[model samples]
Target chain A: MTLRRIFSFLFLLNILSCKTDSEILPSISKEDIQIKWPDYFPQPEYNFENNSLTKEGFYLGKKLFYDPILSKDSTISCGSCHQSFVAFAHADHKLSHGINNLQGIRNAPGLYNLIWQKSFFWDGGARHIELQPIAPIINPVEMGETIDHVVYKLRRNNAYKSLFNKAFMSDSITSQLLLKALAQFMGALISTNSKYDRYIQNPKMNPFTDDEKDGLALFENKCSSCHPAPLFTDGFFRNNGLDSTFIDSGRYRITNLPSDWGKFKVPSLRNVEVTYPYMHNGRFETLEQVLEHYNNGVLQSVTLDPLLRNGIALNNTEKRKIITFLKTLTDRDFIQDKRFSE
Target chain B: MQRQHTLIFIILFIFFKMKSILKVSLITLIVIIGFSSCKKDRKIDVNTEDPSIDKPDNQEKFGTVSIVFSSKAGNSDLELDSVKYTNAHGDSLTISKFKYYLSNFKLIKDDGTVYKQEESYHLINRSNGKTYTVELENVPVGTYNSLNYLLGVDSARNTSGAQTGALDPALNMFWSWNQGYIFLLFEGTSPASQSFNQALSFHIGGFTLPYNCIRSISPSFGSQNVLVTEGHNSTIFVNTDVLKMFESPHLIKFSQVSESLGGAIGSSISDNAANMFSIASIQN
Candidate 1:
């Protein structure tokens, strides 16, 4: 009778122990979310085969993007320079601000629709988006953090350990995985719900006003050769005749070819209204200034775009009409969307 | 009272037996789970390093081949900052830094079949002064007579995204401004140089038209085929003469032209890289 009592007590204890362990540490499971991109947009340049899209990875990426832990002094994040409110552009700063109050040489380009971009930055130095974070993270004037240190910091954090386990099914954090997570989050930031997008989807649903219509016509005639429709960028480097004596040699710095001098990448006109302070150096403060430059300020150089050589013949009324058309590109739904907000 | 006691004893006996059985199974389950989880972690590590680990089906047998790179200026071993080197153009130059990318290895079997190493990229930096030996594992087991390799990152990988191992951007072998690898870098001082400090730096790399600086070399083993048998180790010794960089087709003088010639100097140095390498020894 004594032996039987001992055995029965042990059985009860064993079951209770298992139950308590389960209750104390609940199972963490995350669902995989599909990336939603508009049908009109071209196929993304990034191949998803290497790192498949997963919900846990996206959320982890979003958290990392917003967190200041990636910075060297823990003062800045990718989000600091790229805010969600202004379509991820560094708003009013002509030269994008960096860590320790340092300034970058180029303007902070917007972050959405990046999957379609073959390269990154104003000069398009970074070939892949997965590699793009390395530039800002290690740039001495930027976040100023080493990839090894960032990985070490993430490994030390308890929350990140579990998050990485859930996302990658392993607690071990690596730079490749970190970059993959960043790519997942950045790739998911697809903006295809502007008034223009709706008009493209169904013209009757959201028709453009008369002023916008005139502006679109003028833009098609003048600007569409460089800033094509849909993606809004032809994805080529051109010297838009911004300067004759190249302070910043632009593509020439990369290619080292004299012909590529002053040739900067043709930027997309999407979200142009909100992403103020335009061009590679962010020299123009307003749309009017940009038009005025194209109209008169074009300095002739050997590498200048032949299309803009004669200058874009635009008067005050035409500039206003073009500005109204550019305003339609501002996607309010994307900027105010809570999915990307901190 | 006697009948109740017998019934209680029987019930207690059954409960005891059931408890023992449950406890034994639980422990076994835990042991199995613990072992499997450990194995899963190890597998993840191996998979990231070698993707071929998962798919062993229809795989060929392979062995490892290690290549050692030794730098020399003429007949003597390279001594950085020694100021004891002379170029073809009769200029005295002292090499302070030397680094280059050795990639895209191809093994030529006795039957003339070629086998390319997967993810074959290595950066050789003399400044770090470590063993410049790179071990290429999982090469198909066979007799290889000659091997061909490129001195620069290919155009395909230059345009591709972030790479791992030696090609990792963290290694600092890449040019931040140019979207390409610095195929060969040589920095030193010369009395005849135009710079204030008499410094000479040449960074040779470009993938664009008219200046594509990637160069390849194939070194043959005389009268012997390198046997790469399964479980057998092999080493190939390749000697590099830094003099060849400034000699032959283009005689680069420190006084005439130094510093980053963009692609101008790069083009000539790349052409001369073909004659810079020779196989010293191959042991099976």
Candidate 2:
């Protein structure tokens, strides 16, 4: 071959190799990322505009959430503090322990469809959902690392870099990029297949037991104001008359107000059965114990919510009914959601 | 002798042509250089060192505006040395620490086009302990006719889904549990209180109106135009008064011991500081 022909052949070879980069092209379409929900539920708060939900981003987020590689020590991942089976919240511990056995002040909350949440943390200290993980990553008592450090660590690992490149369109790995990936993962974790959701959508499909029916009534009258249906939270904070003497200072620590002294973000009761040791401080060991606090053990105060100022009066039978009702909120499909596991 | 004369004549003729060509090239190069320098001057808006004439774009110019944050009143560039803000009772108070939230920041142009930043929320904590200025970058370059900035976080983002960037809770600027943001955080000690908790920490943040302490600034550029460059050369100088930051609405020395009281007092301090800035004062 002549010199020009040889050069042309080399150029064609380069083109053939470059075509391999698009091999990992997504097989699943946008329709697969659609979240199925019950008819009774209100419109989902997370619109997924910037971090559009996709199978690729979801799997990437899931891997990062479960993988210990996101941490500094490579031992504690997001799953370490927020376990999947236990409603994503840590159990058997009052406060979440992190790298080097660093203990945080509040319990690690359950990870779920965070797109709906306007704020995060028991104190609501984190205003944005995307910024939620940064607290633990850099907190001395948590992951104990900087975002810049996290990016450096992630970039150095071929697995993470490739995963990021797959999840997002770029491999720059800025804090913004890292955060957007996490948001995609957290945003896609929708839980709408609970039994209660089914019953609400079509009573004939899956009806609630009489005991559960009674319990739900009591819950509506007593708990429904704060833990509103179907997402289970009104997405507001209140001093639920848990304790007058608070060492945690709860929401007041963030708001810097006297009225918000004992106020804490009303937690969603979706997986109340499995997410044990509940409350902001993880004080109650069981659902029955938490009921007792709401019934008879409520502390009275000036800023105490009027709804619970006198506390809900529940009899033994009523308590059983409420427990049964609370059980309906458990989403087996969510706990067993295979997409969340590594 | 005849050959030498011919050589000399040819040399002089070539030299004259070369000189004429050289002069024309020299004039052309000067004109090109002048035109290039003029274009750069328009680009380097605020730099006084640039001697070229300013031809500002018809659209409002936007550039990075940064305030060097500091704790000491005189330590940084955001400090205000004077003030006057009256309460419902018509009493003026001196604010020791002026702390407030700066949210929903936008730069409106002469044509009524508004450019709002993505994450415009900021808790400007200033007082004796805070004079450090914050730098806002990536502003679109143009000649701004007026500026309208919010003193507190906007109501839309105040209650919305997941947010990133400066609005991150990791910065400690967010009130993690309250389900609301702390727009402004002013912290410092008082002469009246000797105890450790004697220091006042004012966290003034209310997105809703009526209690909204947000102030909009419209400074007069006078005869000159407010220049905005694409690079790091543009500037907006704000003259902050230290005295106006203290003893406002609520006495700084007395109310500074409490967190909320200090926040209320910060209203006056912040309002005064807002007046310290002018578009004409901005210089390179």
Highest lDDT: give the candidate number.
Answer: 1
TM-score of 2: 0.66
Segments in model 2 whose C-alpha atoms lie over 4 Å from true places:
A1-33, B1-215, B220-269, B275-284
User: Candidate 1: where is the Cα deviation over 4 Å?
Assistant: A1-34, A152-158, B1-64, B127-131, B136-143, B222-224, B227-231
Model 2 residue B164 CA deviation in Å: 7.4
Query: In model 1, which residue pairs have backbone atoms overlapping below 3 Å?
Result: none
Q: What lDDT is reached at residue B71 by model 2?
A: 33
Interface RMSD of each: 6.9, 13.0
CAPRI level of candidate 2: incorrect
Fnat per model, in the order shown: 0.31, 0.22
Q: What is the lDDT of residue B262 in candidate 1?
A: 46
Worst window of 10 by summed lDDT in candidate 1 chain B: B1-10
Tens digits of per-residue lDDT for model 2 on B118-234?
566665555334444556665666665555566556666755544556564434555433444565565544434454655545665554333454566554556554455766555
Query: Taking the tens digit of each residue's C-alpha lDDT, what string does model 2 give over A1-342?
Result: 643354344434433433343333433345556665666767665676676667777777777777776677888888888877877888677789988897888877787767678778887777666667777776777777766677777788888778777777675666666776777778777777778888887889799998888888888987898988878998888888877788878877655578778888888999888887788888888889988888899898877888887888888888888899989988898888777755
